[model samples]
Target: MSKPAKRKVILGMMAASLALTIGLNPQQADAAVDINASASILVDADSGKILFADNIDDQLPIASMTKMMSEYLILEAIDQGKISWDDEVSISDPVRTLSLQTELSNVPLRQDYSYTVKNLYQSMAIYSANASTIALAEHVAGSEADFVQMMNDKAGELGLESYNFVNSSGLNNSDLAGSHPEGTDANAENELSAKSVAQLAFHLINDYPEVLDTASIPELEFQAGEDETIQMQNWNWMIPGVNAGHEYEGADGLKTGFTSAAGNSFTGTALRDDMRLITVVMGAETRDDRFDETEKLLDYGFDNFHEAELLPEGYKPDGEDVIPVTGGKEKEVSISTSSALRSVIKNDEEELYVPEVSLASELLNEDGEFVAPLEEGQEVGQVQLTYEGEEDVEYLYDNQSSSTPLVADQAVEKASWFTMSMRGIGSFFSGIWTSVSDTVTGWF
Candidate 1:
């Protein structure tokens, strides 16, 4: 990706940092993007590090965005051989009624006809078809109620908190014609925090990258070249060619949603400069506002932050460069980082990273020293990165810091008894000679 014209200016002030000669640091860039929404977040998709966050943990109605969880389960079922893309899913009475309502997002269906799992998935993913989603869910789990349970269980397994899935399609329970999943309030709707939503999207794309192949499609034919076909346009208008006026350079996916309770919301991911960022905005007042707010976030991520080396290969923390080895030919073995530590960092905050060393106790002797016969490239411990900046970073995964291995740089053999005796004798003569020389110099 070509660097935006402003990139030169962003890095122009970094010259002075070069003189530090210790480590590379990012220079502060333009002010952070001001998002207009109830909750929003920006995250590096790879490392899961949160670059920006605003009320990200507040649960709010997410509407159709809830389908991400359903999509995940569907892909997982296919992966596990429990279901296949070519498998036919027969529409049930409730699903057929829902599809025919025309008031909700859907593809019309007849009870006598069946649709392939792949087609229903595409309709749900690209078109946000509510009834298509329900059919797919029922096909996967035998019933919509069971599918909702799977969604919640998968949420728990994915470490998603502040979330609830009442239905597979994300329609308000009332919209389900009182046929909502069991135990849910009639008016209940699926809800999730921007953070949790981003996490779900993160897992979805990573676990099943092929989702993007379908998500990036601007439009598709529900049943192309058939007697009954519905052309569906992706709700995500930011996609290239979908809306030339609103296209973001790298915007590809992931989903857009809206409901009376849940304002316009979007979760989008883009790839540029070898970095993929996920942005979530909820409660936007207008359809354009969600896309506009998403642009600010994507711009902020691309302009103000980048992937940088936190610690270079062979990095050795201060005063922890060597490990003492008892009874070894060498008294100590040199140690250094076994691998490079890299992560997404905000511009102008590069110096805030500090490398910390942690040792593995199992590899230590009674004296807390390395035993004889240390092997080269032997991993003795791990080195991890920690940010010292005032701002706290929230990772999409477990919010854990990045880490690398710490290993011995060279081998250290055990000293033989004969070698130890010879070394002792040599030391005794060396000490005597040094004392004689000191006495002669004093007499002079």
Candidate 2:
């Protein structure tokens, strides 16, 4: 062929390859459902998949929902052995003063009164009690100042950039003019986006499931001393209503909060069968608006979205025949998946494209002898697939990766007599005599 003809042929092949690559990528689908909240989000708690989001990244005041961080930090303390449910907490003058003067939600703690950490946690989770929150923060960090720092640190670790913390309690501290007046610092505004709050709630429920148990209780009464026991009802109404029904049965406990500045806000979770979902709503006009919006979001999620397994469990890439070395009994080796393979899929009409499995070249040497001591299920290579028909795909069409052994597999026999003899002699010199006897006596 002429040089000009050859160049044209090469260009055509390159263009064909590029087109094929583009054809296989996965494309994002449009939002199939609409929600009523100003800012709302629904996510699969297990896969971190965003099933639906509306202005989810917009930052908004979370009101007493800030207690979620308080809950997480406290649980982390319990996990780290810093505090326990049985630990006793005493209400200091600061706690008492905050409890008495603040019109904010509180557990009505009295001066010098002691309560268990468990009760304090219940107060914060169920009632969004600012006083109990401050007390718990002080107990965990020795001071509210330190606790706020810890909260900010955790937010950073969780990649929450829209959030900032000024106090253990979520009270707007800036308006007080009295001697012990509350004030909000510029940093204390403690803003977070709906998506970020949803992320935080997911982590809390997924990691510490006990939180739902405490938060879901509709009513509880406790006392500080000779004073009458106060009845505390869960502010999140969904727990007693729709969530209590079989349709919303997986509904777990979460928090609700409202302030003039923060408006109505809620973070809720529900698990239906194997599917777990987290919904966050913020910036509602009325106290009940947050819960209503959250319910709508969760309803849309459970009604429309479903957990679908894309790949069969235990599906794996097959390994090519590997050559055995020297005197090994087996001449070739192969590998397979040690466990099931699977992926979460949407219930929508869009189907998950089948994955393509690819393996590396067969293991062999220049002499054509098989490599001995081949490990079973060793990741010889990868498998990948591209969607058959898709446009404007963001991610690659095919997923390709290496395989790994579910369990450890090693060679029990040596490949060559020379290699086995060397190992035997080394073992004998090292005071391991059995292997040496076997190797030497085997020659006979």
User: Which prediction has the highest TM-score against the true structure?
Assistant: 1
Q: Tell me, what's the RMSD of every candidate?
A: 8.4, 11.4
Candidate 1: tens digits of C-alpha lDDT, residues 190-257: 99988899999999989999999999999898872248888899889888879876799888899999
The lDDT per prediction is 0.88, 0.67
Error of 2 at 175 (Å): 6.0
User: Distance (Å) between predicted and true CA of 183, model 1?
Assistant: 2.4
At residue 54, give the lDDT of candidate 1: 81
Indicate the TM-score of model 2: 0.71
Best by lDDT: 1
Q: For candidate 2, what is the lDDT? A: 0.67
